[model samples]
Target: MTDRTPGEPTGLDIALQWAELPPEHLKAALQALEPELARRHEMRMLQARLEAQGAEDRRSHLLYLSGLVGGFLIVVAMLTASVIVGINGLPWLSAMLAGPSVLSLAGLFVLRRVDSGTARQVARAHDAALGAAQPTPGAGVV
Candidate 1:
Protein backbone atom coordinates (compact mmCIF):
# COMPACT_ATOMS: atom_id res chain seq x y z
CA MET A 1 0.00 0.00 0.00
CA THR A 2 1.02 3.58 -0.55
CA ASP A 3 2.04 5.64 2.48
CA ARG A 4 -1.21 7.61 2.41
CA THR A 5 -2.00 9.45 5.64
CA PRO A 6 -5.52 9.95 6.98
CA GLY A 7 -5.45 13.61 5.83
CA GLU A 8 -4.23 12.73 2.35
CA PRO A 9 -6.22 14.21 -0.57
CA THR A 10 -7.78 11.63 -2.87
CA GLY A 11 -8.25 11.94 -6.65
CA LEU A 12 -11.65 13.62 -6.35
CA ASP A 13 -10.38 15.92 -3.62
CA ILE A 14 -7.42 16.88 -5.79
CA ALA A 15 -9.69 17.41 -8.80
CA LEU A 16 -11.95 19.69 -6.74
CA GLN A 17 -8.98 21.63 -5.43
CA TRP A 18 -7.81 22.45 -8.99
CA ALA A 19 -10.52 25.08 -9.40
CA GLU A 20 -8.39 27.27 -11.72
CA LEU A 21 -7.46 24.46 -14.14
CA PRO A 22 -8.19 24.79 -17.89
CA PRO A 23 -11.70 23.72 -18.95
CA GLU A 24 -10.45 20.72 -20.97
CA HIS A 25 -8.32 19.41 -18.08
CA LEU A 26 -11.22 19.88 -15.65
CA LYS A 27 -13.48 17.97 -18.00
CA ALA A 28 -10.88 15.19 -18.19
CA ALA A 29 -10.63 15.03 -14.44
CA LEU A 30 -14.43 14.82 -13.97
CA GLN A 31 -14.62 12.18 -16.71
CA ALA A 32 -11.97 10.13 -14.93
CA LEU A 33 -14.21 10.05 -11.84
CA GLU A 34 -17.34 9.07 -13.80
CA PRO A 35 -17.13 5.30 -13.23
CA GLU A 36 -16.55 5.65 -9.49
CA LEU A 37 -19.44 8.11 -9.21
CA ALA A 38 -21.74 5.75 -11.15
CA ARG A 39 -20.76 2.82 -8.92
CA ARG A 40 -21.47 4.83 -5.76
CA HIS A 41 -24.86 5.84 -7.14
CA GLU A 42 -25.77 2.21 -7.88
CA MET A 43 -24.63 1.15 -4.42
CA ARG A 44 -26.83 3.78 -2.83
CA MET A 45 -29.83 2.62 -4.86
CA LEU A 46 -29.27 -1.02 -3.90
CA GLN A 47 -28.87 -0.12 -0.21
CA ALA A 48 -32.09 1.88 -0.30
CA ARG A 49 -33.95 -1.04 -1.85
CA LEU A 50 -32.63 -3.43 0.82
CA GLU A 51 -33.55 -1.02 3.62
CA ALA A 52 -37.12 -0.69 2.32
CA GLN A 53 -37.48 -4.46 2.06
CA GLY A 54 -36.16 -4.91 5.61
CA ALA A 55 -38.57 -2.35 6.98
CA GLU A 56 -41.51 -4.06 5.28
CA ASP A 57 -40.44 -7.45 6.63
CA ARG A 58 -40.14 -6.06 10.15
CA ARG A 59 -43.59 -4.50 9.95
CA SER A 60 -45.15 -7.71 8.65
CA HIS A 61 -43.48 -9.80 11.36
CA LEU A 62 -44.65 -7.40 14.04
CA LEU A 63 -48.24 -7.61 12.82
CA TYR A 64 -48.16 -11.40 12.71
CA LEU A 65 -46.69 -11.60 16.23
CA SER A 66 -49.24 -9.17 17.59
CA GLY A 67 -52.10 -11.12 16.07
CA LEU A 68 -50.75 -14.37 17.50
CA VAL A 69 -50.43 -12.83 20.96
CA GLY A 70 -53.90 -11.38 20.78
CA GLY A 71 -55.35 -14.75 19.83
CA PHE A 72 -53.52 -16.43 22.70
CA LEU A 73 -54.77 -13.80 25.15
CA ILE A 74 -58.31 -14.32 23.96
CA VAL A 75 -57.98 -18.07 24.46
CA VAL A 76 -56.57 -17.57 27.93
CA ALA A 77 -59.37 -15.21 28.86
CA MET A 78 -61.98 -17.70 27.69
CA LEU A 79 -60.39 -20.49 29.73
CA THR A 80 -60.23 -18.30 32.78
CA ALA A 81 -63.88 -17.36 32.38
CA SER A 82 -64.77 -21.02 31.94
CA VAL A 83 -62.99 -21.99 35.14
CA ILE A 84 -64.62 -19.16 37.04
CA VAL A 85 -68.05 -20.21 35.79
CA GLY A 86 -67.40 -23.81 36.73
CA ILE A 87 -66.32 -22.77 40.24
CA ASN A 88 -69.52 -20.76 40.58
CA GLY A 89 -71.57 -23.94 39.97
CA LEU A 90 -72.53 -23.32 36.36
CA PRO A 91 -71.21 -26.51 34.77
CA TRP A 92 -73.22 -26.20 31.53
CA LEU A 93 -72.19 -22.58 30.92
CA SER A 94 -68.54 -23.37 31.72
CA ALA A 95 -68.52 -26.15 29.14
CA MET A 96 -70.03 -23.82 26.59
CA LEU A 97 -67.33 -21.20 27.17
CA ALA A 98 -64.59 -23.87 27.10
CA GLY A 99 -65.81 -25.21 23.75
CA PRO A 100 -64.84 -22.02 21.92
CA SER A 101 -61.41 -22.09 23.55
CA VAL A 102 -60.73 -25.51 22.05
CA LEU A 103 -61.79 -24.30 18.64
CA SER A 104 -59.67 -21.18 19.02
CA LEU A 105 -56.66 -23.32 19.90
CA ALA A 106 -57.16 -25.40 16.77
CA GLY A 107 -57.60 -22.27 14.65
CA LEU A 108 -54.40 -20.78 16.04
CA PHE A 109 -52.46 -23.94 15.16
CA VAL A 110 -53.84 -23.98 11.64
CA LEU A 111 -53.11 -20.29 11.17
CA ARG A 112 -49.52 -20.76 12.35
CA ARG A 113 -49.00 -23.63 9.95
CA VAL A 114 -50.52 -21.66 7.11
CA ASP A 115 -48.38 -18.62 7.88
CA SER A 116 -45.20 -20.72 7.90
CA GLY A 117 -46.20 -22.36 4.65
CA THR A 118 -46.86 -18.96 3.11
CA ALA A 119 -43.44 -17.72 4.24
CA ARG A 120 -41.77 -20.72 2.63
CA GLN A 121 -43.67 -20.14 -0.59
CA VAL A 122 -42.67 -16.48 -0.61
CA ALA A 123 -39.01 -17.40 -0.09
CA ARG A 124 -39.16 -19.94 -2.89
CA ALA A 125 -40.74 -17.41 -5.19
CA HIS A 126 -38.09 -14.83 -4.30
CA ASP A 127 -35.35 -17.32 -5.05
CA ALA A 128 -36.97 -18.22 -8.33
CA ALA A 129 -37.31 -14.58 -9.28
CA LEU A 130 -33.59 -14.13 -8.64
CA GLY A 131 -32.77 -17.16 -10.83
CA ALA A 132 -31.45 -19.19 -7.90
CA ALA A 133 -31.77 -22.96 -7.83
CA GLN A 134 -33.14 -24.12 -4.51
CA PRO A 135 -32.69 -27.78 -3.67
CA THR A 136 -35.63 -29.93 -2.81
CA PRO A 137 -36.22 -30.12 0.93
CA GLY A 138 -35.63 -33.85 1.53
CA ALA A 139 -33.42 -34.57 -1.48
CA GLY A 140 -30.11 -33.63 0.13
CA VAL A 141 -27.81 -35.85 2.23
CA VAL A 142 -29.59 -38.25 4.53
Candidate 2:
Protein backbone atom coordinates (compact mmCIF):
# COMPACT_ATOMS: atom_id res chain seq x y z
CA MET A 1 0.00 0.00 0.00
CA THR A 2 1.27 3.46 -0.87
CA ASP A 3 0.24 6.57 0.96
CA ARG A 4 0.79 9.73 -1.01
CA THR A 5 1.58 13.15 0.32
CA PRO A 6 0.90 16.30 -1.70
CA GLY A 7 4.05 18.22 -2.78
CA GLU A 8 6.37 15.31 -1.98
CA PRO A 9 8.66 14.36 -4.85
CA THR A 10 9.37 10.73 -5.75
CA GLY A 11 12.79 9.13 -5.10
CA LEU A 12 13.84 9.68 -8.70
CA ASP A 13 12.71 13.28 -8.44
CA ILE A 14 14.74 13.70 -5.28
CA ALA A 15 17.84 12.29 -6.99
CA LEU A 16 17.38 14.64 -9.93
CA GLN A 17 16.89 17.58 -7.60
CA TRP A 18 20.11 16.67 -5.75
CA ALA A 19 22.00 16.99 -9.04
CA GLU A 20 21.99 20.80 -8.70
CA LEU A 21 23.68 20.89 -5.29
CA PRO A 22 26.67 23.26 -5.35
CA PRO A 23 30.22 22.28 -6.34
CA GLU A 24 31.27 20.75 -3.01
CA HIS A 25 28.32 18.35 -2.73
CA LEU A 26 28.31 17.91 -6.50
CA LYS A 27 31.28 15.49 -6.45
CA ALA A 28 29.47 13.21 -4.03
CA ALA A 29 25.86 13.45 -5.21
CA LEU A 30 25.79 13.92 -8.95
CA GLN A 31 28.93 14.02 -11.05
CA ALA A 32 26.98 13.75 -14.28
CA LEU A 33 26.10 17.45 -14.61
CA GLU A 34 29.65 18.75 -14.25
CA PRO A 35 30.53 18.37 -17.93
CA GLU A 36 27.33 20.11 -18.95
CA LEU A 37 28.00 22.93 -16.50
CA ALA A 38 31.55 23.32 -17.77
CA ARG A 39 30.37 23.48 -21.36
CA ARG A 40 27.79 26.09 -20.37
CA HIS A 41 30.41 28.18 -18.57
CA GLU A 42 32.72 27.98 -21.56
CA MET A 43 29.97 29.05 -23.93
CA ARG A 44 29.00 31.98 -21.72
CA MET A 45 32.57 33.18 -21.43
CA LEU A 46 33.08 32.86 -25.17
CA GLN A 47 29.96 34.87 -25.89
CA ALA A 48 30.94 37.61 -23.47
CA ARG A 49 34.42 37.92 -24.90
CA LEU A 50 33.16 37.92 -28.46
CA GLU A 51 30.64 40.65 -27.63
CA ALA A 52 33.39 42.75 -26.08
CA GLN A 53 35.48 42.38 -29.22
CA GLY A 54 32.54 43.36 -31.38
CA ALA A 55 31.89 46.46 -29.28
CA GLU A 56 35.51 47.48 -29.53
CA ASP A 57 35.49 47.06 -33.29
CA ARG A 58 32.38 49.21 -33.60
CA ARG A 59 33.93 51.89 -31.41
CA SER A 60 37.04 51.92 -33.56
CA HIS A 61 34.99 52.25 -36.71
CA LEU A 62 33.03 55.14 -35.22
CA LEU A 63 36.20 56.93 -34.16
CA TYR A 64 37.69 56.57 -37.64
CA LEU A 65 34.48 57.88 -39.16
CA SER A 66 34.46 60.83 -36.76
CA GLY A 67 38.03 61.64 -37.74
CA LEU A 68 37.11 61.55 -41.41
CA VAL A 69 34.18 63.87 -40.76
CA GLY A 70 36.42 66.27 -38.88
CA GLY A 71 38.87 66.31 -41.77
CA PHE A 72 36.11 66.91 -44.31
CA LEU A 73 34.66 69.76 -42.26
CA ILE A 74 38.09 71.34 -42.01
CA VAL A 75 38.51 71.25 -45.77
CA VAL A 76 35.12 72.93 -46.36
CA ALA A 77 35.68 75.42 -43.57
CA MET A 78 39.19 76.21 -44.81
CA LEU A 79 37.88 76.92 -48.29
CA THR A 80 35.28 79.29 -46.92
CA ALA A 81 37.73 80.80 -44.41
CA SER A 82 40.31 81.37 -47.11
CA VAL A 83 37.77 83.41 -49.07
CA ILE A 84 36.92 85.38 -45.93
CA VAL A 85 40.62 85.80 -45.01
CA GLY A 86 41.32 87.18 -48.50
CA ILE A 87 38.41 89.59 -48.34
CA ASN A 88 37.83 90.39 -44.62
CA GLY A 89 41.27 89.16 -43.55
CA LEU A 90 40.87 86.88 -40.44
CA PRO A 91 43.53 84.17 -41.00
CA TRP A 92 43.65 83.20 -37.30
CA LEU A 93 40.11 81.80 -37.38
CA SER A 94 41.00 79.48 -40.23
CA ALA A 95 44.10 78.34 -38.31
CA MET A 96 41.92 77.65 -35.24
CA LEU A 97 39.69 75.32 -37.29
CA ALA A 98 42.80 73.51 -38.55
CA GLY A 99 43.95 72.92 -34.96
CA PRO A 100 40.76 71.12 -33.91
CA SER A 101 40.84 69.00 -37.09
CA VAL A 102 44.42 67.89 -36.36
CA LEU A 103 43.51 67.19 -32.74
CA SER A 104 40.67 64.93 -33.91
CA LEU A 105 43.20 62.84 -35.86
CA ALA A 106 45.21 62.34 -32.66
CA GLY A 107 42.10 61.36 -30.72
CA LEU A 108 41.20 58.84 -33.46
CA PHE A 109 44.66 57.27 -33.21
CA VAL A 110 44.27 56.87 -29.43
CA LEU A 111 40.80 55.32 -29.79
CA ARG A 112 42.09 52.82 -32.36
CA ARG A 113 44.79 51.75 -29.93
CA VAL A 114 42.22 51.28 -27.17
CA ASP A 115 40.04 49.26 -29.51
CA SER A 116 42.91 46.97 -30.45
CA GLY A 117 43.74 46.41 -26.78
CA THR A 118 40.19 45.43 -25.96
CA ALA A 119 40.14 43.06 -28.92
CA ARG A 120 43.40 41.50 -27.73
CA GLN A 121 41.91 40.90 -24.28
CA VAL A 122 39.00 39.10 -25.89
CA ALA A 123 41.40 36.94 -27.90
CA ARG A 124 43.32 36.14 -24.75
CA ALA A 125 40.17 34.97 -22.99
CA HIS A 126 39.39 32.75 -25.93
CA ASP A 127 42.85 31.25 -25.77
CA ALA A 128 42.46 30.62 -22.03
CA ALA A 129 39.15 28.85 -22.54
CA LEU A 130 40.69 26.71 -25.25
CA GLY A 131 43.56 25.76 -22.98
CA ALA A 132 41.08 24.77 -20.29
CA ALA A 133 39.34 22.60 -22.87
CA GLN A 134 42.45 20.52 -23.66
CA PRO A 135 42.80 19.28 -20.08
CA THR A 136 39.28 17.81 -20.09
CA PRO A 137 38.69 16.28 -23.47
CA GLY A 138 36.44 13.67 -21.84
CA ALA A 139 33.04 14.00 -20.27
CA GLY A 140 34.29 14.08 -16.68
CA VAL A 141 36.97 16.66 -15.84
CA VAL A 142 37.78 15.08 -12.49
Candidate 3:
Protein backbone atom coordinates (compact mmCIF):
# COMPACT_ATOMS: atom_id res chain seq x y z
CA MET A 1 0.00 0.00 0.00
CA THR A 2 1.12 3.57 -0.75
CA ASP A 3 1.76 6.09 2.00
CA ARG A 4 -1.04 8.67 2.35
CA THR A 5 -0.05 10.93 5.28
CA PRO A 6 2.82 13.23 6.26
CA GLY A 7 4.04 11.01 9.10
CA GLU A 8 3.61 7.82 7.13
CA PRO A 9 6.46 5.97 5.44
CA THR A 10 7.12 6.82 1.79
CA GLY A 11 7.17 4.36 -1.13
CA LEU A 12 10.97 4.11 -0.82
CA ASP A 13 10.58 3.40 2.86
CA ILE A 14 8.10 0.62 2.12
CA ALA A 15 10.46 -0.80 -0.50
CA LEU A 16 13.29 -0.68 2.02
CA GLN A 17 11.07 -2.54 4.48
CA TRP A 18 10.89 -5.34 1.92
CA ALA A 19 14.70 -5.61 1.81
CA GLU A 20 14.53 -8.94 3.66
CA LEU A 21 12.14 -10.55 1.15
CA PRO A 22 13.20 -13.57 -0.96
CA PRO A 23 14.93 -12.64 -4.22
CA GLU A 24 12.08 -13.93 -6.46
CA HIS A 25 9.43 -12.05 -4.50
CA LEU A 26 11.49 -8.85 -4.52
CA LYS A 27 11.84 -9.03 -8.31
CA ALA A 28 8.10 -9.55 -8.72
CA ALA A 29 7.28 -6.61 -6.42
CA LEU A 30 9.65 -4.36 -8.38
CA GLN A 31 7.97 -5.36 -11.65
CA ALA A 32 4.55 -4.60 -10.21
CA LEU A 33 5.75 -1.15 -8.95
CA GLU A 34 7.18 -0.02 -12.26
CA PRO A 35 3.92 1.37 -13.70
CA GLU A 36 3.16 3.40 -10.53
CA LEU A 37 6.65 4.87 -10.56
CA ALA A 38 6.34 5.86 -14.19
CA ARG A 39 2.93 7.47 -13.59
CA ARG A 40 4.26 9.52 -10.67
CA HIS A 41 7.19 10.69 -12.77
CA GLU A 42 4.80 11.84 -15.53
CA MET A 43 2.61 13.67 -13.03
CA ARG A 44 5.63 15.52 -11.62
CA MET A 45 6.72 16.54 -15.11
CA LEU A 46 3.27 17.95 -15.89
CA GLN A 47 3.17 19.86 -12.61
CA ALA A 48 6.58 21.35 -13.32
CA ARG A 49 5.53 22.48 -16.79
CA LEU A 50 2.39 24.19 -15.45
CA GLU A 51 4.35 25.96 -12.76
CA ALA A 52 6.98 27.15 -15.25
CA GLN A 53 4.29 28.53 -17.59
CA GLY A 54 2.60 30.38 -14.73
CA ALA A 55 5.89 31.97 -13.72
CA GLU A 56 6.70 32.93 -17.30
CA ASP A 57 3.31 34.61 -17.72
CA ARG A 58 3.80 36.61 -14.53
CA ARG A 59 7.26 37.74 -15.61
CA SER A 60 6.00 38.77 -19.05
CA HIS A 61 3.15 40.82 -17.55
CA LEU A 62 5.57 42.59 -15.20
CA LEU A 63 7.94 43.39 -18.08
CA TYR A 64 5.08 44.82 -20.17
CA LEU A 65 3.91 46.98 -17.26
CA SER A 66 7.47 48.19 -16.66
CA GLY A 67 7.79 49.16 -20.33
CA LEU A 68 4.59 51.23 -20.22
CA VAL A 69 5.66 52.97 -17.05
CA GLY A 70 9.13 53.70 -18.42
CA GLY A 71 7.64 55.06 -21.66
CA PHE A 72 5.30 57.39 -19.74
CA LEU A 73 8.16 58.64 -17.59
CA ILE A 74 10.34 59.39 -20.60
CA VAL A 75 7.52 61.39 -22.25
CA VAL A 76 6.90 63.35 -19.07
CA ALA A 77 10.58 64.20 -18.68
CA MET A 78 10.90 65.29 -22.30
CA LEU A 79 7.87 67.58 -22.07
CA THR A 80 9.17 69.09 -18.84
CA ALA A 81 12.50 69.81 -20.45
CA SER A 82 10.72 71.36 -23.45
CA VAL A 83 8.71 73.66 -21.21
CA ILE A 84 11.82 74.73 -19.27
CA VAL A 85 13.65 75.51 -22.49
CA GLY A 86 10.68 77.53 -23.76
CA ILE A 87 10.54 79.62 -20.57
CA ASN A 88 14.27 80.29 -20.89
CA GLY A 89 13.67 81.78 -24.39
CA LEU A 90 14.75 79.02 -26.84
CA PRO A 91 11.64 78.63 -28.98
CA TRP A 92 13.17 76.43 -31.72
CA LEU A 93 14.94 74.13 -29.29
CA SER A 94 11.75 73.75 -27.19
CA ALA A 95 9.76 72.82 -30.30
CA MET A 96 12.40 70.28 -31.30
CA LEU A 97 12.31 68.60 -27.91
CA ALA A 98 8.50 68.60 -27.72
CA GLY A 99 8.08 67.06 -31.19
CA PRO A 100 9.84 63.82 -30.21
CA SER A 101 7.82 63.62 -26.98
CA VAL A 102 4.60 63.70 -28.93
CA LEU A 103 5.90 61.03 -31.29
CA SER A 104 7.01 58.84 -28.38
CA LEU A 105 3.60 59.09 -26.72
CA ALA A 106 1.96 58.09 -29.98
CA GLY A 107 4.28 55.11 -30.26
CA LEU A 108 3.41 54.04 -26.73
CA PHE A 109 -0.30 54.28 -27.49
CA VAL A 110 0.12 52.11 -30.59
CA LEU A 111 2.09 49.57 -28.59
CA ARG A 112 -0.66 49.37 -25.97
CA ARG A 113 -3.23 48.77 -28.69
CA VAL A 114 -1.13 46.00 -30.20
CA ASP A 115 -1.07 44.08 -26.92
CA SER A 116 -4.83 43.58 -27.11
CA GLY A 117 -4.53 41.96 -30.55
CA THR A 118 -1.55 39.71 -29.75
CA ALA A 119 -3.55 36.52 -29.16
CA ARG A 120 -5.33 36.91 -32.48
CA GLN A 121 -2.02 37.59 -34.21
CA VAL A 122 -0.41 34.49 -32.70
CA ALA A 123 -3.35 32.30 -33.73
CA ARG A 124 -3.30 33.73 -37.23
CA ALA A 125 0.41 33.10 -37.55
CA HIS A 126 0.05 29.54 -36.31
CA ASP A 127 -2.71 28.86 -38.82
CA ALA A 128 -0.63 30.38 -41.59
CA ALA A 129 2.31 28.14 -40.73
CA LEU A 130 0.11 25.06 -40.72
CA GLY A 131 -1.36 26.02 -44.08
CA ALA A 132 2.08 26.51 -45.58
CA ALA A 133 3.29 23.13 -44.29
CA GLN A 134 0.46 21.13 -45.90
CA PRO A 135 1.01 19.84 -49.47
CA THR A 136 -1.15 21.08 -52.32
CA PRO A 137 -3.87 18.73 -53.54
CA GLY A 138 -2.74 18.52 -57.18
CA ALA A 139 0.97 19.18 -56.77
CA GLY A 140 1.93 15.62 -55.84
CA VAL A 141 -0.93 13.66 -57.42
CA VAL A 142 -0.10 12.16 -60.77
Candidate 4:
Protein backbone atom coordinates (compact mmCIF):
# COMPACT_ATOMS: atom_id res chain seq x y z
CA MET A 1 0.00 0.00 0.00
CA THR A 2 1.11 3.55 -0.64
CA ASP A 3 2.12 5.66 2.31
CA ARG A 4 -0.56 8.23 3.13
CA THR A 5 0.22 10.76 5.86
CA PRO A 6 -2.48 12.19 8.03
CA GLY A 7 -3.34 15.83 7.19
CA GLU A 8 -1.57 15.56 3.86
CA PRO A 9 -2.62 17.92 1.05
CA THR A 10 -4.66 15.98 -1.48
CA GLY A 11 -5.37 17.08 -5.08
CA LEU A 12 -8.50 18.95 -3.97
CA ASP A 13 -6.57 20.65 -1.16
CA ILE A 14 -3.78 21.66 -3.53
CA ALA A 15 -6.32 23.02 -6.01
CA LEU A 16 -8.00 24.99 -3.24
CA GLN A 17 -4.62 26.35 -2.05
CA TRP A 18 -3.75 27.36 -5.64
CA ALA A 19 -7.00 29.28 -5.82
CA GLU A 20 -5.89 31.14 -2.66
CA LEU A 21 -9.39 31.17 -1.16
CA PRO A 22 -9.85 32.68 2.34
CA PRO A 23 -10.80 30.62 5.40
CA GLU A 24 -14.45 31.58 5.12
CA HIS A 25 -14.38 30.69 1.44
CA LEU A 26 -12.98 27.29 2.34
CA LYS A 27 -15.91 26.73 4.74
CA ALA A 28 -18.29 27.77 1.99
CA ALA A 29 -16.57 25.32 -0.40
CA LEU A 30 -17.08 22.49 2.07
CA GLN A 31 -20.73 23.40 2.44
CA ALA A 32 -21.18 23.33 -1.33
CA LEU A 33 -19.37 19.96 -1.55
CA GLU A 34 -21.54 18.25 1.04
CA PRO A 35 -24.76 17.81 -0.96
CA GLU A 36 -22.94 16.64 -4.12
CA LEU A 37 -20.96 14.13 -2.08
CA ALA A 38 -24.11 12.90 -0.39
CA ARG A 39 -25.83 12.45 -3.76
CA ARG A 40 -22.85 10.43 -5.08
CA HIS A 41 -22.94 8.21 -1.99
CA GLU A 42 -26.64 7.64 -2.45
CA MET A 43 -26.06 6.61 -6.07
CA ARG A 44 -23.40 4.11 -5.01
CA MET A 45 -25.74 2.64 -2.40
CA LEU A 46 -28.50 2.27 -4.98
CA GLN A 47 -26.11 0.43 -7.33
CA ALA A 48 -25.05 -1.95 -4.57
CA ARG A 49 -28.67 -2.64 -3.68
CA LEU A 50 -29.48 -3.42 -7.32
CA GLU A 51 -26.52 -5.79 -7.54
CA ALA A 52 -27.62 -7.66 -4.43
CA GLN A 53 -31.14 -8.02 -5.80
CA GLY A 54 -29.85 -9.38 -9.12
CA ALA A 55 -27.72 -11.96 -7.30
CA GLU A 56 -30.71 -13.12 -5.29
CA ASP A 57 -32.74 -13.45 -8.48
CA ARG A 58 -30.05 -15.59 -10.12
CA ARG A 59 -29.83 -17.83 -7.04
CA SER A 60 -33.58 -18.29 -6.99
CA HIS A 61 -33.59 -19.18 -10.70
CA LEU A 62 -30.86 -21.78 -10.17
CA LEU A 63 -32.78 -23.39 -7.33
CA TYR A 64 -35.95 -23.49 -9.41
CA LEU A 65 -34.13 -25.12 -12.34
CA SER A 66 -32.45 -27.68 -10.09
CA GLY A 67 -35.73 -28.59 -8.46
CA LEU A 68 -37.36 -29.00 -11.86
CA VAL A 69 -34.55 -31.25 -13.11
CA GLY A 70 -34.56 -33.29 -9.91
CA GLY A 71 -38.31 -33.78 -10.08
CA PHE A 72 -38.01 -34.90 -13.70
CA LEU A 73 -35.30 -37.40 -12.77
CA ILE A 74 -37.44 -38.75 -9.95
CA VAL A 75 -40.29 -39.22 -12.40
CA VAL A 76 -38.03 -41.15 -14.77
CA ALA A 77 -36.86 -43.33 -11.90
CA MET A 78 -40.46 -44.08 -10.95
CA LEU A 79 -41.27 -45.05 -14.53
CA THR A 80 -38.23 -47.32 -14.67
CA ALA A 81 -39.23 -48.98 -11.41
CA SER A 82 -42.74 -49.53 -12.72
CA VAL A 83 -41.34 -51.22 -15.81
CA ILE A 84 -39.06 -53.41 -13.72
CA VAL A 85 -41.91 -54.39 -11.43
CA GLY A 86 -44.09 -55.27 -14.40
CA ILE A 87 -41.41 -57.51 -15.91
CA ASN A 88 -40.34 -59.15 -12.65
CA GLY A 89 -43.87 -59.50 -11.20
CA LEU A 90 -42.91 -57.62 -7.99
CA PRO A 91 -45.89 -55.90 -6.25
CA TRP A 92 -44.06 -54.25 -3.33
CA LEU A 93 -42.05 -51.76 -5.37
CA SER A 94 -45.22 -49.97 -6.52
CA ALA A 95 -45.91 -48.64 -3.02
CA MET A 96 -42.29 -47.58 -2.71
CA LEU A 97 -42.46 -45.76 -6.02
CA ALA A 98 -45.58 -43.67 -5.39
CA GLY A 99 -44.44 -41.93 -2.22
CA PRO A 100 -41.22 -40.24 -3.44
CA SER A 101 -42.71 -39.38 -6.84
CA VAL A 102 -45.64 -37.57 -5.29
CA LEU A 103 -43.40 -35.72 -2.85
CA SER A 104 -40.94 -34.62 -5.53
CA LEU A 105 -43.69 -33.40 -7.85
CA ALA A 106 -45.25 -31.43 -5.03
CA GLY A 107 -41.90 -29.87 -4.19
CA LEU A 108 -41.33 -28.93 -7.82
CA PHE A 109 -44.74 -27.24 -7.95
CA VAL A 110 -43.96 -25.18 -4.89
CA LEU A 111 -40.54 -24.22 -6.27
CA ARG A 112 -42.06 -23.05 -9.55
CA ARG A 113 -44.55 -20.88 -7.67
CA VAL A 114 -41.79 -19.34 -5.59
CA ASP A 115 -39.61 -18.74 -8.64
CA SER A 116 -42.42 -16.87 -10.41
CA GLY A 117 -42.93 -14.67 -7.38
CA THR A 118 -39.19 -13.93 -7.15
CA ALA A 119 -39.09 -13.07 -10.86
CA ARG A 120 -41.82 -10.49 -10.35
CA GLN A 121 -40.03 -9.01 -7.36
CA VAL A 122 -36.74 -8.81 -9.28
CA ALA A 123 -38.45 -7.09 -12.19
CA ARG A 124 -40.00 -4.51 -9.88
CA ALA A 125 -36.68 -3.86 -8.14
CA HIS A 126 -34.89 -3.42 -11.47
CA ASP A 127 -37.51 -0.94 -12.69
CA ALA A 128 -37.39 1.02 -9.45
CA ALA A 129 -33.61 1.25 -9.46
CA LEU A 130 -33.54 2.38 -13.07
CA GLY A 131 -36.16 4.98 -12.33
CA ALA A 132 -34.23 6.27 -9.36
CA ALA A 133 -30.98 6.56 -11.31
CA GLN A 134 -32.52 8.51 -14.14
CA PRO A 135 -32.20 12.34 -14.00
CA THR A 136 -35.51 14.11 -14.02
CA PRO A 137 -36.31 16.84 -16.52
CA GLY A 138 -35.12 20.34 -15.43
CA ALA A 139 -33.39 18.87 -12.40
CA GLY A 140 -29.71 19.05 -11.37
CA VAL A 141 -28.76 21.08 -14.42
CA VAL A 142 -26.66 24.19 -14.04
For all predictions, the C-alpha RMSD in Å is: 18.5, 26.0, 19.1, 24.1
Candidate 2, lDDT over the whole model: 0.58
Model 2 — TM-score against the truth? 0.44
Q: lDDT winner among the candidates?
A: 3
- Model 2 agreement with the true structure over 67-135: per-residue lDDT tens digits: 667756656665666567646654454444333433443444444333556556555654554454344
Model 1 per-residue lDDT tens digits across residues 1-142: 3334799777668787665788888888788778866886788888889999999999988878887777777777888998998799776666656653345453564365445565565555544533423335688778
Displacement of residue 72 (Cα, Å) in model 3 is 0.4
Clashing residue pairs for model 1: none
Return the lDDT, model 2, position 15: 63
lDDT of 4 by residue, 30-114 (tens): 7776786677678888888999999999999988888778777777777778668746755445444543344545455545544
**Candidate 4, after superposition: displacement of residue 92 in Å?**
2.2
Residues 9-108, model 3: lDDT tens digits: 6667767867789778777877888887789788888888999999999998887888777777777787889899879977666665575334545456
lDDT of 3: 0.69
Q: What is the alpha-carbon lDDT of model 4 when measured against the actual structure?
A: 0.64
* Residue 70 C-alpha lDDT in model 4: 78
Any residue pairs clashing in model 4, and if so which? none
TM values, all candidates:
0.53, 0.44, 0.58, 0.60
Q: What's the lDDT for all of these models? A: 0.68, 0.58, 0.69, 0.64
